[model samples]
Target: MALWIEAESVERRSNATEDDLQAIIRAVYRQVLGNAHVLDSQRLTNVESQFRNGDITVRNFVRAVAQSDLYRSRCFETSSPYRFIELNFKHLLGRAPQDQAEIAEHVQIYHQYGYEAEINSYIDSDEYIRSFGEHLVPSARGNRTQSGIKNVSFNRSFTLMRGFAANDVGKSAKLISDIGGNLPTKIVAPSGASGVYSNTGKRFRVAVSQVSYGPRVTQSVTTFEVGYSQLSQKIQNIQKTGGKILRVTEVA
Candidate 1:
């Protein structure tokens, strides 16, 4: 079982062969498109040609794919503002936003500068250069802890990843409420052979605060312990009851 799904890094070698170029093309689609199945018609042949002919660096090729209409329609137009920003971080930078400020900054940029600038901002970032360089493809760095990356980012990034087989067609932001409310995101391990679940049979405690409606309003706090499979539904139930989740901590 794999704990995380990583985009295979494909670098343009000085003496790269035709096979290498094809691999790079595949890698670009797999990474930038979030494992979405790309029909022949959906592929950027012109961009691939430029990459093959040594006309553009891998960075430029990544930028082109991200800017393409395919990416725009599937990811941007149909998604919420938060979802779009979230996908941009995952697809372009290979991670999740570190904090609310990062998400807010990108949202502000999109509101002011427009879509092209939003895409350009990630590609043109110093972090992008340092992490991926000009030739290497961007990959998920969520599973590994790195200096300067927040401890919470690992769980958040894994949330964005969902699972190895899951595509990025989901329209809602997975981390929006967590990031916006400054809440700690509980790491839910994915199911199946591709997903690693260390705490398979373990349980977690969900602390929630609920307000009762009546002539005299009263607030009550409660805690519920549930298995991994029941965690999501339990949270949904809490939200449906107009409850605010205060915290989710693993049971020892």
Candidate 2:
């Protein structure tokens, strides 16, 4: 994060010297005090020490020192008395002030005061969530042939899905589409050899539809409707073949 302050002008005062600095300080003091002004030599000395220590520049220090209530009466007598002395310097000069390190330091100070909200607004613009799939049924066979059984249910299964921020929709969709075909598969039902069924001739085959992607919906969408339709069709076919659909007592 970065911060900055804009002073009106600077180049016109390029030749400013120590005398100019003293004049500005005196002006600030006079502005604060009126007819019975008393100069505080001790405080002035401390200000000079701060400047020598590089804690404050001559320009900034003079203004801050002048802002005391004593000086305010003389310098800024109006209701909208300008407390910012930097602006005054800019007005006296012609162009904006130049201080690279000062700007950087000011920016750092602003960040210290917790201005990260502004920083993040310019950086992150998306959010996302992860999803997992589950198995619905296990493989099994009936004693008598049925008309509508096609696929076997599995003991366990899983799938993956993504929920993306609105701004990330384009990229998210592309990525989902690219890896959609390679997603992990769940065994709805195991082969008869796995002891899922006793009859070797009663093995079931698994099939998956193309991965579907779309904006989130409040209720079920056309995709789910279509999937249900296909499942119903398969059930009908298995029932016609004399295979019975197994009914479970409870769902895990």
Candidate 3:
């Protein structure tokens, strides 16, 4: 699971609806690609349809965005190594570079393996595999910054700590384009003593938390578990809802 501020905000939502899927697609356009116009493109529409139909996961949707021609022109083409690498961290991993060295490390990859390889590195990293598996989306949390906040895993409410919110013009714009904040889904490991997991399926079992937002003035966001197997559905829920997940376990 991926989130902007805290890790606890992410979860595996089995009850995600068509509206939630649409909202999620919008979230991807604004947050991952940073171009609202891309939402109108047939490519994105196709990807959305595939994801909604379960032909793809949020992780696959994310991969499509990064590998899309739109992302190449907007993010990679003609950009400095530093700028490109930094954007990759934001778009692919959903966070900024941990430090100059991290940037340098990625830069070296870009130089040696070409742009595509650089992109794959982030998606293929252990962090991606462990936190998100292949069915979740990535969101920004100051995972690498010296000013990063301590990660709050799945259990209790998580507040977006400082340093994770991007300060740059484009970065801030992307956050604004979606819903002016992060989503309520996350991919995290199980919590406490191994929690529960079906002895079937080849993927990880994640604990999911449901999220909702209200009144920007109040900065009101709330999350809870309506039940173990399902969550509250707002129906075509155009509201912002996503977070970091915790206590995930690999099943069968």
Assess every candidate by TM-score. 0.76, 0.20, 0.52
Per-residue lDDT of model 1, residues 1-252, tens digit only: 565656566788999999988998898888889989999998999999999999999999999999999999989998877779899999999899977689879978999999999999999999899889999988898777876888899889988886557688656666654664457777765567655434436677888888988999999999888875566557657765778878777688
Largest TM-score belongs to which candidate?
1
- Model 3 alpha-carbon drift over 4 Å, by segment: 1-12, 35-39, 143-252
In candidate 1, residue 71 scores what lDDT?
Answer: 93
lDDT of 3 by residue, 146-188 (tens): 2332232221011111223322223111111111112332333
Candidate 3 residue 218 Cα shift, in angstroms, is: 61
Error of 2 at 35 (Å): 6.1
Estimate, for each residue in 1-252, the C-alpha lDDT of model 2 and write its tens digit: 111112111111345466655554444333222213455642466675564455665344434444445334433343111111212211122111122232234335435643333222211212100000010000111111323321210110011111010111010111111112222223233334432311112222223333234684232211211221133344334434444333201111
Candidate 2 TM-score to native: 0.20
Per lDDT, the best of the predicted structures is 1
Cα lDDT for residue 102, candidate 2: 24
